[model samples]
Target: MASESTTEDHSAVKKPNGFPPLLSKKFGITDIKQDAVKWNKEWEAAIASLTAADVLKEISQKLDDSFFTPQHMELFHKSLRSLQTNVAEILSNLLNNGHFDTIWLLLNAAEQRKHILEGLKRASEDPSTIWGPDCRALCPEVTVSNFLSQSGKGFIDFLTRVAEIFGSPITPAFLPNSWWEQASNLPNPWWGQASDVSPQRQISQSTKLVFEVATITRNQFIGEWQFVLSSAFSIVSDITNRGEGMKEVLHFMENTKGHVARCLAEVKTTFRDKPIIRCENCTKTPDDIGQNVRFMVCSVCKTKLKFEVHYCSQSCQKEHWSVHKKACGKKKVTRGLSGTKGDFLWAFSDSDPVANLMRNLPKKEGRLTLRDIGVNPCNGKRSPAAERQAKMLEADKDVDYFLFTASGEPVRFVIDDLGAKMIFRINRGMIMTQPTDTTGVNAIGEYMLKLMSNYPGLSRDIIIKQLCEEYGEDIAEKIVELEQMAYSSDLLTVRCSVA
Candidate 1:
């Protein structure tokens, strides 16, 4: 558990508004920190202000309407309408009976919801300060609840009400017979089990339980939507399952999947770190390998890059060398794609496929040097090149760039734009190193030179100067001559064609 000081620190640093207005209205409380007497008073007052229709409105608004299509939303609304009787009964039960167990559950649910909003609020404030599971460890007021455990039958128990509300819309597989497993399997306080504790203790436990359940459900809910959509799509994609308008069904589901993906993508920015620190090479944590082993950090990347890249063993490090060498100890820049709204991933622009081909195409040498072919070579300053590449990228918004390996294998570099940041990624063949040497003259140099000259102030002297410093005076002069020749050839071709 986190100490009293840590909990206080979180509360102190969080928003001063106490709680979000929408959340406060939903929970039927003015403040989350209230004691049993104050909380009950506020709760009763808030509930009294609502009619049965108001209760239904609150319940229906649980899931965002904009996220679903009209068709899908109609289905959801159908399910919600069917559950109106149940909603009324629950509301009546709450107003009349107001059982201790139900109140406890409701209180915990509200707490959980508040915690998520707080975390997201923090993330929106300072994105670079990590806010995921590892950072979450610093504040321990919120312990995980067994009711939401997916490995065991515990998660099934948490879904009991959700299952009730959605009813027949939920697939049988979503709630299998295995879901009937005994609640005793739950390690945390099962529903109604709080009766054993005194009223004072119950209130205290409710506050703590709210944090725990909120964290679990927040993380789980954000992560599960894609899985749910994928699972449904997979079931419907089968040939044997084909029916009339199956194509339309697949199309609708596919669009919904994209909508769900975009929503999850937004949620992902709130928490981007892995739950545990894992080996960058093998991707296994110390716990997975055993107590006898420990993870090692890349000393070069640590000292030079100031970024810790881990490996479980010497072998994994060596195996990953071919891939890691590209970005190892190289300077990287953090650019905000979404302004101040979300989280972002780090991207490397050490090599530009276009600029690389331009520099190497003019080479008269038999085999291309690493630098000529856009490999960092890990010998010279690479940040300048990265800076230049960043500028080059800004001039164009094209996301897809096609390039060929020395082996003539085609590969693509894609710019993946998250709401928070942009990531330069390769779909496949990332491990295949750039060509060392190849036969024949690639006339593509002329087109490349034409493109490179477009950059402001990139005169012959400037290109010559930059190249001379990076390579040598000899190679630099040769490249400038090639550029001149290529330009003259282009003019000549145009004249001949015109004649």
Candidate 2:
């Protein structure tokens, strides 16, 4: 709160709604600075006294309350401006000290206040007349510039650091929906309503700034595409599994998918005109070897072929053919074999579990990834079964399974007879099964299957303990021996770790 004398002095300068006047020509710089300092100190005190819960409660109140007078709007602007200044100061200190978590919280709070302001602006009569001037007065650019200048950082540099901390692009995803849309309608802080400023000049400067930021941001995001996509997918999967905030999470996923698509498009475009310097298959450079290697472009991208791939050797080209064939000439391919079938399989094998699992289980047409068994790699709404499967897969990263099909379609399988048998059922009326011994092997297999069916990522030690409790120690040890043998022989692809 400002001093009584100061408040009284501003009384005569009040608007029709009895609120203090805007920071226009009527208010002197001295008065504005004094009031801003007072308000900023008050805001700091208020924030310090309250917990996160209290801040959230206040935000909720602001969001729910519809009837805000001009006085309320003016007070809100003052508070927001004060908060922004404090946030900037805190952010500068945090950045200097490398306290990223605190910085994230501050930025998140600033974003929430931005949303609250937008909500107020939207609820007002003639939004342009009511909140437009206030928005221009607030001038986010001032806060941005002050923080960046104090921190001795440029916008791109600041954003890059933010991206590294957040593990995502520093885009509107960090803010609420409609933030950019609302900002676009607001006045540019750099080029205000000055008589000397032309509309064309304003547009040109704004466009240049937008383009510069967008280009750098996009490039940075592209460089971290693997991490960006992986982290986004993980977030989406976790949210879906929790079964909370479905609508909001889905909306976010949709936006993220668009970003991923854009990044991929940029990658493709970047490669389009560039000379091939390395083997696409092995990712090796000619400099790695003594001789300059000749490269073979994909025949598809060339006149002779329909696939887009390059290799330093004919053997490498031939080796990648099975996976590449499925994606040749298609607009997009969701999954491609990363290497030779054996290489792909070997990556998942500390033992021959995959090979053994394939041998014991019935052979079926088509490849199956975790997705085929109900795990989803992308985000959004998922079936309850899919959600469960995803949770199971996430619980353990030590094990992985994938099935490849000639047709590039998913293969589905079900465990039958309580692990005594596994049925591979395909659409083409094909079935395969591995017989289990009636006494020792059958019971252990059944138990193992049931345990894994419910909890795919359960630890091996837990399973062994459960087996010991159910059967005798001798039988449990025997089962473990057999399991290890099966895994070693590639007859079961359950355990990915080496014994």
For model 2, the stretches where C-alpha displacement exceeds 4 angstroms are 1-282, 285-296, 299-302, 311-499
**lDDT digits (tens) for residues 1-499 of candidate 1:** 1222323343233211111234245555534333433543454455445443343233222221222233432343343344433333332332232121121121222332333333323322332211222222212212223321222123223334333433344321122212112211222323234455434322231223232222232222222221111221222222124433333323322222222222223233233222344566666667779977878878887889777677789999898888878878884321122111111211111144422333334353333222222222233233443334333433432523233333434232332332211111111112112221111011122222333344444544544444334333464444444344322233233223322
Q: What is the Å distance of residue 205 in model 1 from its true position?
A: 24
lDDT of 1 at 309: 71
lDDT of 1: 0.33
lDDT by residue for model 2 (63-126), tens? 1112223354355444333433333343333333322222222122233233223222232212
Candidate 2 worst ten-residue window by lDDT: 426-435
Predicted model with the maximum TM-score: 2
Summed backbone clashes in each candidate are: 1, 19
Q: Could you tell me every candidate's TM-score relative to the true structure? A: 0.22, 0.23
Report the error of model 1 at residue 134, Å.
27
lDDT of each: 0.33, 0.32
